[model samples]
Target: MFAALPAGASGSFGLHPQDGPHVDVRIAITDDQVTLSLTMNLVFLDELIPQRREQADLIDPPESSQTIAALLEYFASEQPLLVDGEIVEPRIEALYIDDPSPELMPLFPRTGMRGLRKIRFELIYPLSSPPDRVQFTWNSYPMSELTGGPLVIKAELTAEGILDIVEFTEQERGYTWHRTGQDIQSRMLQVPEPVVQQEDSSLLSTISIIVMAVGAIVLIAMLVSGRPAEALATLILMVILVPLFYLVGRPGNTPPTKEEARTIFDSLHANVYRSFDYVDESDIYDALSLSVDDELLEQMYATIFRGLIMQEEGGAVSRVTRLTPLNFDLENVGMLSRPTGPGLPEREALGFNVLYTWQVEGTVTHWGHSHSRTNNYTARYGVIATEQGWRISQMQPLEQDRVDDDPEFTLDEDIEL
Candidate 1:
């Protein structure tokens, strides 16, 4: 008995079963069409179309046409592709069954597996012009009885020279691709400028000097005229005026509290990672200027950009998705010397050195695949108050370790559609 899975079908099981059925969805968009391909193992195919289970010849079955028709009908009804907010039907381009590769054999093991063949469907949805937006909703999931859990679909999309990956589950079944000339997941951190307290002592100093000079002349004249009482009164007035001027002329430069320092450093550190979101070097540098010192901006950008590149993925840049500060210690706080202006003498300001440990979750998508990694890093950062605000002055990496690495494939690299 062959029955098509209902729309938005999902399993009631808790977790995904190990070595269970999986689906790979690849989507590529060109000027006039959107190409979509789905690949699944034989067990999953049999679960979808039961007639395949009874077939003697899996590769060149006599009922291959019927099986393909059933698949096409099922997808046409269950999976709806939207282009520019309009529902578009996908026409089947090709369907075939091939032997599973040695590397993929582990994914679909021989033990308890119905067959070693893998089924693939290449489909195309026509577009009048380049679409501004495209969305796909996956509604078919393997039954709990067949896979013991809900299906996991690794979906990869390539459009406008940008590649992105989205994992689709029962909970997250829809993926939308936009033609905007920007990384969808990338964003700049909004770090507020540092507040600086301004001080001007020239007025008070001038007033004090005038008062002192007048008092000195009066006292000297009074003493010269042998008027000691008047001279003593003048001296007392001068003493009071000088102290008042000194108190008023001093600037109130209070250092940040420990909690405040943590907040400041947190924003600065996060902005450093967010700076890579921009595509242009000048844009990245502009973003970095918000949190990093000008002296360290270029060097920091180079170092961090190099670190973000995944060499295994052919030098693909990873986008940071999440950042978590595990441990933050305000090691010390002291004066930071900075140049007042060009050709001006350097002055000291409030600064702090911090030792912190954090973890970054980054994703690298390349060639229709997505690789995710979580890295734990411990580093020392020097944050100082500047005219712009508080900025990261120095960064010294202490330790870095890759905590997790997960690579997901939407299609086999060797298999060309």
Candidate 2:
């Protein structure tokens, strides 16, 4: 049986805003090859290859070799990959269209229910050795007037032990990855460093002005009353006492109280988890930099991100929803030295160590369902006062235990109780 395009569709096919087609692209780089996989709705495929609109049966549809050839040709011209500043051609690995899972069928547009399906294309680009840099440009976003606006493409990249997601829009369609000293540097958004306000000095200056004015008036009145010796003594005393009062009122670097330490740690700990809210690797790093020292930024990011992954659940990254402090103990306060390069002198900074116990509620959503897990963690953190305010300089995890786990199926928005 042959499937035909929906009837009554004019110059362009329109879908409800909520039911518009979604595209996902995954790029995996290995030692010898880079594999790219793209998946989208059949509506997008039909728009790209109009001839496919008349194909027989979307499930394992019989397509002529010429059609496949045309698809490959189109990608070769539109989607290009440059490795080490040279363009590399990709070889077609697989091309097919199939019905989506029953659970996801309702998410498709109702207007094209009979003919729409899911289509996937996998391509491989060979490399002589591991690439130092790779650039991928996407120019295939559908520009049909049927689309409410430019489509959004979510791209997941896995290269050099790093995993990140980036959204490609019509305005920005290119991505570049650079290998930097055993680390991969993808597109990272720069976050401005927070400004630290200094202590107010106006109060001390005000007191000095008041003392001088009062002393000047007394000296003038004493001279007019013929008490010159007494006035001279008073003038000398004012010069000495004014400086003494100013020195007494100046603020000093006093160690934070236990209560203050607790408040500071709470904010730093929450910020660490909050960094994961961003999907972009660079954004995560940027957010973390606000609360983490530069020397520990990369290490902390990897450790926390790895801890959030649910290995039993197919390596899905869990989203942190809530954090509750269970117990906090200020361990020690002393001068800590910031790590510096060899031959550079270490700078001493005020720092404290705390043993903290906290509970985290995390959720992982996949296939229209949510799995929540609550875990308790105990760790010792080292926080130091820097030019950027207090930052986490070190961390040592002592214990971790899963407290609760629950799986719940999310109801489709279209379904009513």
Q: Taking the candidates one at a time, how many backbone clashes does each contain?
A: 1, 0
Segments of candidate 1 deviating more than 4 angstroms: 1-20, 26-77, 89-135, 143-147, 154-167, 175-186, 200-255, 275-289, 294-322, 334-350, 361-375, 385-389, 401-417
TM-score of each: 0.55, 0.46
* Tens digits of lDDT, candidate 2, 306-377: 879887666778877677787889999878777656898878777789998877777764311245788878
Score each candidate by Cα lDDT. 0.68, 0.67
- Top candidate on TM-score is 1
Best by lDDT: 1
* lDDT string, candidate 1, 216-250, tens digits: 99999999999999999989988897998787667
| Candidate 2 whole-model C-alpha lDDT, 0 to 1 | 0.67
Give lDDT: candidate 1, residue 185: 25
Candidate 2 segments exceeding 4 Å error:
1-18, 56-61, 64-67, 101-111, 114-116, 143-147, 183-315, 318-417
Worst 10 residues of 1 by lDDT: 408-417
lDDT of 2 at 214: 93
